[model samples]
Target: MLHRLVEPAHKQQHQFILDRLVGVWLTLGEFMGDGDYGDVIADRRVGVRVEISEGQDRYVCPACEKPMILASHRIQNRTKERFYFKHLFDDGSCSGVAGLGEKAIAALRFGQTKESVEHQRFKFRLLESLELDPSFTNTMAERRWVDEDGVKWRQPDVQAHCNGQRIAFEAQLSTTFLHVIVERMVFYRRNGGRLLWLFRDLDVSHFRLAEEDIFYSNNRNAFRVTEKTVELSRAGKHFVLECVWHVPTLTRGGVSDKLAHGIVRFDQLTFDVSRGGVPRTYFYDYEGARLQAEHRLAERAQTERDQELRQAFENFYLPFLNGELNSDQVETEWPELLSRFRSRGLGLPAWPDNPKGPFHYLLAAYSARAGVPIGTDHEDLVKLAHYLVDKRKHTLWIFRLMLEAYDQKEVMRRYDTTGRWLSKVKQYRDAFRRGDSHYMPNRGFDDLLCFLFPEISDKLVQAPGTFLGSART
Candidate 1:
């Protein structure tokens, strides 16, 4: 019972040191239901936490299967912050407490240093193309540029000055982390320089995630430098690039863009730095084209809706006019048509006690404007015109204006051999002027007439005296 326990104390001290070592090694964690372990360092570099706040995404230690949380640290006087995963509860049951041995760290460093031959060749070719252009000056390969604050710096693959403007070009050959790309863009923008990301080729059918990120962000445009482009540059004695862009087109589904590419000179491209100091360089105006395409699609949709409404009205009104439906049936169905018209911002008066009188009057006015019978039993436009002037005297003002607005006087003259229709119109005009006639204007029926025949809307707003003065002399 009094035996000394010296071994336990020594083992506890060793475990404490191992815990610290494992803490440094735990940079990755697995999100619940996700097979891959998300890299916290990359997330921190981009200032976006994949797991976000606590409990947002259930993350666990990749090796120990214990609950984990994202942890961050910033050393004094350093601009960059470090991020890693830490165990929620540190019970010393996990074998990862021993840390990742030295051999594994060495392999990681070796793999990062081994750059692909293709990437190196692309860098050299881009440098060569810049040198061939006389417009470019002070062009260098792998130059380190310091920001204005002197707290940040970036070493672009190729840098140059053209037209007193600084431009940096980077060749994307393989998978590059989003953080690295974003950081470079921010640094260049703040330093008053333009950054252009170049690629070797693009497979639009099988676009990589990285390619999509670049393509969509830069006005749906991507640039490439291929062997053919370099040869053209050499022959033309200037800088050239193969530009790939999306041309917006209206499709049956919606507005879509098709892929288009061409060889363009450096000077031929638009270099705009107006939008929030972010540089936009492209051969085509993708934004403008897309906006125009969207506007066209909206107009087409509106036209189609107007035609559909016109057809529905014709179907209901023609049957009632042809004696296929009785007045009771029309009264019951008139409310439904009113509801449809209201949906399109067209308001009509409620169903009256005698709907046929007003309905027939409106049908006569529409038939006159259209130069054909629409919902009336009249055999021709002249007959409908005579009925409107003789029976619907209260609506005679708008009916005359509609005739002049739609150029229906010729049809009236062609049929009225005795000048009866013209004489009736003049007699009504003289009586209305003398204020001794039943030429009252019904505002409700006028609105209904305008809705049925929109061509006379402008003329309906004019004063009766003003409209008649401008009428055919």
Candidate 2:
């Protein structure tokens, strides 16, 4: 069950997140309010406020002013310190264990909306992950530094040190933060620190208004996964995320996302800052090389599919659809779902020479690889689709696969089995849908992406950091 996998990671990540939230929450205390723990509204009749501070702690109630007796106590001393839970209330009216949780969240004023809370928890996880990494040490939160104006201002969020180099990380939950990217980057450049940006998801309105342009790229891949449903989802759960590396820089537009989120992390990262924190040109080259290697390994693992099964996804599902999805319904009810795909390189040419159809096949193939089901309406499916399509737009997925395999094997075999050159194709429409997870595209269709690298490079140059999650300022 999803719970089994997430519960453990949830517990661990929850603790880690709470620790990081301690800093963020505490830093926001004054802005939120000065009381110990309280949540009330303009209509005081509606909300709850539990004030605990000074003399009020040993006792209970602002009314009692009485020295309260300890009703019970359980204390176990350990190396980490001790666990102590006691009840002493002059008023004897408190929510108890459940109240404690409610109060904590109320103090933060976290919204109950799923995305909002998830983002909050995610920000906590991001900070925590950054803290524990050996690559990032010496965490600094809430410090005053003088800017050029000689005026003192508080920092954006957390700054950390690794290998004697300090890096600044800002979790942007509002659109206003977008305008500050260049300023933040300037800070990084001036302070000689690497910048880690956390931008709000643009598609969602929950986040505040933000700028559109400061990032490297917004192109992500598109795909779908059928029969895979989320198991456990909660305020306290976490997921492990992985960085999709090696898509080629010019193609990718230079971007990275915090993995080990959405799912709780299984283990610590090896913490390789050497390859990280380098100039964009450096990182781009590394990803390009790795992607080349991955394509070869993947094609070899392909399984044989019968023609019958191929037809199931071909006419209607060459991209793996059993039939055409209802466009009328999707556009009416989930218009953004369509926009999400179109936004992520769906319209881009797979390569320079041949533009339209190859790009479509590239999206289709990427969807197959990610285990994602094809459709534009469902939220889950849309995200998966966005991821793959974005990848094709940036990597020229089809072409790169062939280009890399050729570079590795010195001969293109499989489809032809004995040919030194990869099968040549007059057009991408030459590709065939062999059914579920199977594709026998036209010759050279496999190299559709790579053939257009020169053009992709030009685009990258014109719009540096324009794809991936680059706008997450």
Candidate 3:
């Protein structure tokens, strides 16, 4: 059955333990790493094992060339594991055995870049596509540096020169390792080096997706929802946003897909401070609501402004964009002006009237330049439909705007339902859950909010022929 409501988390300590089990949902409290046989490689052969320090069953020692069978048994109830079920093999299971419930961690050749393209080459291409030129090439990736203070570390990222200062880069993958990378960069900067994180394909392991739905019975089209949390604002409460985006590093989900040739791959914050010039993010303690509301407002306002900017491209700004407005012609012949019908068949939302907003100015200019007077005619609308439907790539500005708008719509819906009571909360709360973790009240939000937060359509974007998988977007 589907979960109807959520309750609070039982223990905050579990969150710390939970972060280590990077991939997949975990109600099981165990630190799982991918490898086998005690990180040992003998005669160039790799051995794998599964060891659970805590749980019903403990460790398993398999015989060489064959899965081991139990040769003895014991039970210990006072251990971390609630169940003391034991399997012993005195005959041959282990050459050496230690630790309770020990098993080899699974091994996955998870996030290797394509063999044909090196990471540096791909990054150079990406920078070139972005029109960025590096002034120097002192990359920090795997480079050892010893500062004047005897501090030493290796940079596993990029270091470039830009605009007369050194630029440091940490091309981070979307995993818990990101925290380590960012920490190193932070340390580097503290010791006097100009560095900026050149964020790569940020979305990787998020469980989210976007899909459009058509309601034939109601003669309406709607977007379907899922278990994804789309943050309307990039400035607040978004530490996990990068995790989903960084999932490109995690491949090998199944037996066939793990080794499949050329498998598909893919894939912010803010706040304020009471006094410091440095930014201080106000989290969920007391000031979270204010920060949340403010950022949302900023995003909403920004989206509207972006739409206006798009309009301006077709109107007054088109000449500037195309380098033609200043070319001449103080006053063109009336016939010539009348004959131009470039954007005659386009439609869009009405230009906003908030003159104080920069959006208004941007829209006024662009739409006018293209002769698409903001949905002035059926032809204009048809032109717009064609542009949106037939276009291959989506506009980031437009995408951000739409996302912001959708977020506002959801916010409005939730805001109105604030005081309402959920009938199934108690019933669902009473339901039993597996594991040693206790129940908390916030998982209640998890139950209901999970529905509100739909999955992303796409996750990380990887190079062609890469085995890394992307998000569903």
Candidate 4:
């Protein structure tokens, strides 16, 4: 009796399940018996899957074309699992509705319809446009195409051949599942065909998620067909579409995108087949422009950061140089300034004694590089250079090296117009050559000098052995 009951139950199984979204049907028994069917049911891959809730009307019965609900039940002591589809409203309208359960009202929803009037009109418009274009040939509407494996097929709204390439145009007027879009793209790509998703209209000011799904996935390009485009195609005697895309722009804040659109002939668009994981179509190179904008934004940001850092350093150092802040006070505030530099991946050398700190050395170097006074009341870099050589003999060699290394030969020549500074420099050079400790190189500030002026770092007399080196190490 038990064997007879099992045989009868298996004989009453539903024949097939239909996915209305992608317009694909699958044999129920064959899909259920396949080992990989679990992945399909889980919606983990890009293929046909019954993704309907208990009351939702996504999948339907193949025989009656009525909404179907998935039913699951356990059998035996081992908790064996089995799943099947039954009519949501079983009113004796179909044979597959028997022994399922009580019926419920099917919810009317958008995207549940097979095709809308707008979608059909858009399809016909594309068909007409393709027929008008001399570059396209063998154009057909609602043509079915089989993949290489012959296991899957897609009936594109309009199909055509362009320059020895198969082109399938899908008119999208409503929201489509991402998997549906990806599956169509994969199918067309595998069959050596290109799929172009067309929109009836697109509002750049506001973008629906579905529109973005198509726009962003196609290299930030979205094409639309309307009366204007169709008229243009008729006038130009070629296929035309209003192509909308994002134009990368560099702004004060950062890189931004500006919406741009224009009516373009089909030949103006690029048919890119080398790219993978995206629709092989675009009107402009948005990705390339975005990368260039990002690079320029980075350069602008770095320039701004350098300006802010220079201003802050001058603000802090000027006051101390004029004796408004003592060594202890400068030391107290040094760490905070150092923290800011550290945040920008720059390391400052340790604070030296007040009279011999980096303040004067940096001021002289900056003034010389600018060809004008930066911190002090000196009229020109010549005066600053003279002052450093006369009063700060300990910094003479490094300052002289900076002047020469930084390409300030004119300033040096102007400083020695009367030969006074030059004579003094020669005396200091002679003393240094005679191993005079008074004119020895300041090795302690090598790291700080390098950090402040990286151009002359290679010309420093000694190898860096300070905080900059230690931090990098």
How many steric overlaps are in each model, in order? 0, 55, 79, 0
What are the root-mean-square deviations of the candidates from the true structure over C-alphas? Answer: 15.0, 23.6, 30.5, 15.0
lDDT of 2: 0.33
- Specify the poorest-scoring 10-residue window by lDDT in model 2: 4-13
User: Which one wins on lDDT?
Assistant: 4
Q: Kindly list the per-residue Cα lDDT of model 2 for residues 91-122, writing each as its tens digit.
A: 44532323345345433322221124445554
lDDT of 4 by residue, 239-327 (tens): 99999899999887788889898988787777664345465678888888888999998888887787788677767766755457776
Q: What 10-residue stretch in candidate 4 is worst by lDDT?
A: 464-473
User: In order, what lDDT does every prediction score?
Assistant: 0.64, 0.33, 0.28, 0.66
Shift of residue 330 alpha carbon in model 4, Å: 2.0
Per-residue lDDT tens digits for candidate 3, residues 243-279, read 2111011212311111111111111222233332222
List candidate 1 stretches off by more than 4 Å.
1-117, 132-134, 231-238, 267-281, 285-288, 321-323, 352-361, 369-380, 387-414, 420-473
* Model 4 segments more than 4 A misplaced: 1-120, 204-209, 234-238, 248-257, 268-276, 285-302, 352-361, 366-473
* Backbone-clash count (model 3): 79
**Candidate 1 residue lDDT tens string, 166-273:** 999876554455556667778888898888888758666555566676777677778888788889989998899988899999999899879997898888777565
**Residue 455 alpha-carbon offset, candidate 1, angstroms:** 6.5
